[model samples]
Target: MANEQTSRKVAIIGTGVIGNGWITRFLANGFDVVAFDPADGAETRARQSIDHAWESVEQLGLHEDASRDRLTFVSSLEEAVLDADLIQENVPERTELKQNVLAEIDQFAKPTAIIGSSTSGIKPTELQEKMKYPERFVVAHPFNPVYLLPLVEIVGGEETTKEFEQQAYAFYESASMKPMIIENEIEGFVADRLMEALWREALHLVNDGIATTEEVDKAITYGAGLRWAQMGPFMTFHLAGGQEGMRHMLKQFGPALKLPWTKLEAPELTEELQERVIAGCETHAGDRSVAELERQRNEFLVKLIDLVEDYWP
Candidate 1:
C-alpha cells in the first residue's frame, strides 16, 4: 500500500546483510530510505535482499507507504545522509574504519539527526570517539534479518546523552521493534555474552567429540529454544519451580552450579575442526545454498513472528 511520502527518512550507510535488514525494516514501516556503500555491487545486493524480504514483509503486513520504489541508493555518503532524519551506520566492525566513517557521517548529516551504528562488537564509546557531535551518536545494533527480529540493543558512549538514547528508543519502537537500552558500556553488551557462553560450550562439545552439530541444534530447538521463544530463561525457570516459582527452584538447584558440568572457554578452532563443523552443517542443510537458507529462514521468521507476537511481555 504505497502512498504519499513520510518524513521518517533513514540513511543506511552500508548494504551488507545486516544493512539490508535495516533497510527492509525501515521500508516496511513506510520510511523513505537513502542507502550508500563504497563496495562494488552493494546497491544491487541490498535491493535484491529487500525484494526477497519485502515478499515476506508483504505477507505479514505493509505500511501505507511501504514500497520498493521508496529506496534511493545514493553514490556518496554525503548525499545519502544529507536529508535523513536518522543515519544508521552498518560498516565493518573495525574500530579505525568505523571512527573514520562515523566522523564523515557526523560532518555531513544534520546536527539533530541521530547517527546510529550497527556495531555488535565495538562499544559505542569507542565508535563515537572520532565523531564531532558524539552526543548524537548511539549504538543501534540489530540481529541478522533485522526486519524480522524485534530486539535492537541501544548503548550509549561516554559522550552519548540520555536524550539521544531515548530518541533511538522512540524511533525503533515506531518501527515495530523492541529497543533494549543498556546503561553500561561493556563489550558484547548483553545477548552476545549469553549466546557466547552457549556457543563456547557447543564448540567444546564438538571439540571433545561428544556431540555433532546436529545434536547441538536439536538440544536447543527441542528443549530450551521453545521456551525462549515466548519468555526469557529467567521467566521460564521461574515457572519451572512448581508453585513456589524461582525461589524454590533456585534453592533446590543452586548447589549444583558448583559442579564441573560445563565449559565456558571456547575450544581452539583448528582447521580440521572447522572443516568438520562445516561438513556437519552442510549435512544438516542438505543441498541448500547460503542464499536459499537465508530465504527459508526469512520466510519462517515472517510466519513465526506473526504467530508468536501476541505472547510478548
Candidate 2:
C-alpha cells in the first residue's frame, strides 16, 4: 500500500494522555490532525502537552512539513472523522463507553478510513462488536510516550480484513513506528501480558513486605531492564545459553518453570500496601515533578532508540 492523499489526515477522538500522544506523533510525522474532545479546556491542554513534547520529537527528527499549526480542534466527533483517513479512539478504558464511542466513530468515519483503538487489554473483537464497519477496526495498542517509543502492537479481530490490516501496517510504518502485526486476537495482546505478569509479581513482593517499591524499581533499572532495552527476554536468554543458545537454556532451566518462584495472580490492593507503594515511590522521586521525570525519560529514550537501531538484529 502506498501513502495517498487520504492518509495524510488523521482524527483523534479523545484528547487524554494517549490521545495527545497520538496527536503529537501524527503531527510530528507531518500529518494533518483533526482532534475532537468535549471536555472543557481540552484543546488548550492538548496544545500545551504537544508544546511540552515538541522538543523531544524535534530531537528524534521531524518530517519536513511537520508543524504544530497543522492540528485543528473540531467541535464534534463527526466533524473530526469526516475527512480523516485514520481515526484513532483513545477514550477511557470502560468497555461500554469504548463500544459507544467506536460505534459513533464507525458511523461517522469514511468507509475507507481505518479506525484504531488504544486499548491496552480489550480484545479487538470485543471492541469492534458494536461497529457497523468492524472489518476496518484494529487494536493499535501503544506504550506511554508513544512519540518516542517505536513499538505498536497491531491486532485484528475475526471480522477484520487482511487488506485493511496491511494498510494499517503501512500507515503506522509511515509514521516512523515499528508496528508488529499479531496474528491472533487476545486480551492484553503480547507486551502487556508480559508486563502484567511482572506487575503481579512486583505487587506480591510489596504485599508480602519482601521489598519496597524503590527496591523493585532498582532491580529492574540496573538489571533485566538494561538487557531488555536492547534484546528482549528470548534473545537475552539465548546469549545466556552460550553457544548452545535457547535449546540448551530451555533444557537446563525447564524444570524451574514448575517452581513456586512467581505468582500468577495479583495481590490484594489493601490500603497499607497501596500507601507503602505510593510512599516509597514519592520518597524515591523526591522533588522531581512528573513533568521533570518525563523530560529525563524522553532524553534517555532518544539516545536509547539510536543505540537500539545500531544494534538491532
Candidate 3:
C-alpha cells in the first residue's frame, strides 16, 4: 500500500543535474520520489547529489525533518515509474531520444499519471505526439536548482485537456511552486524566449569585445537583477514611470528601440568561444568548487527570499 501521507509518488527518469534537483524538490515537498537513470553508478551519484542538495535545503530552512527519508532511488526505469502519480522526465534534450523514451514509459504508466517534461525549449506538442496517451503529457519546466526556485512553467500540448492542465497547475502549487500556465504550446515557452533574446544580445556584446563575462554579470547582478529579485520587469518599469505607468515609459524610451540591435541568432559554440567563456568563469569563480558555489548561491537566494517575505508582509 502507498503511503497516504505522501502527497504524490513522483518518478524522475534521469538522475543528471536536473533529475537530482527534481528529486530534492519533490522530497522536500513531501513527495515520495523514485529516481531512475541508465548511466553507470548513477544511483550513487544521484544519492550524493541529493544529499548535498538536502544539506543546503536544511541550512536554508527549506526542507522538513523527515525529507531525507522520503526520497528513494530505483535502478530500473520501470520500477521508478511503477505506481507513480507524476513522472518527471529529465532526460537529455534530443527529439528522437525523447520520443523513444516516452513511448517506452507510456506502456507502463497508469492512465491517470501525468508525465511532465523538464525540457527548457522543446514544445510539449512535439513530445506528446509520440506518447500513447498524449493528453497525459505536458511540460512542467523548472529552472536550475529546482529545490530553491519556485517558478514552474506549465504548458499544455495540443492533445492536453484543460482538466489535466488544471490538475498539473494545482499539483505544482500544492508542492509550493508558483506555476504559470501557458495558453498555447509555443517553441521555447515563455521564460526561455526572454532568456534567448537577452542571451543573443549578450553574446553579440561579448563577441564584439564590448564587455567581458564578469562585466556583463556585474551589469545585471548589481543593477537590474536586484530589482528583478523583488519584482518582475513590467512591474519594475511601472514603478519607474511613477503615476504615469508603463505607457509613459513606453512613450519616453520606445524610440530607442529602433536603434541598430542585435540579430536574434544563436552563435555557434566554437571552441575558441567555449574556452574563453569557461576560462572567464573559472577566473570569476576563483577557489570555489562547483558544490561550494551552489551552496553560496542557495544561501544568498534564501536571504533574499526572507528579506522579501518580511518586507512585503
TM of each candidate vs. truth: 0.83, 0.82, 0.80
Q: State residue 24's C-alpha deviation in candidate 2, in Å.
A: 0.4
Tens digits of per-residue lDDT, candidate 2, 1-313, equal 1234446999999999999999999999999999999999999999999999999999988888799999999999999999999999999999999999999999989999999999998989999999999999999998889888989999999989999999999899888889999998877899998898899899999999999999998888656776676556654554455455544555676566667778763455455754554455445556765455545655766787666566643
lDDT by residue for model 3 (183-222), tens: 9888888988888878878888999999998888778875
Q: Identify the leading candidate in terms of lDDT.
A: 2
lDDT of each: 0.82, 0.85, 0.76
Model 3 gets an lDDT of: 0.76
Worst 10-residue lDDT window for candidate 1 reads 277-286
Give the per-residue lDDT of model 1 (tens digit) for 183-206. 998989998988888999999999
> Any runs in candidate 3 off by more than 4 Å, and if so which?
1-6, 62-65, 261-313
**For model 2, the run of ten residues with the poorest summed lDDT:** 238-247
Cα lDDT for residue 24, model 2? 97
Best first by TM-score, ranked: 1, 2, 3
Model 3 clashing-pair count: 0
Model 2: residues with Cα > 4 Å off, grouped in runs: 1-6, 265-313
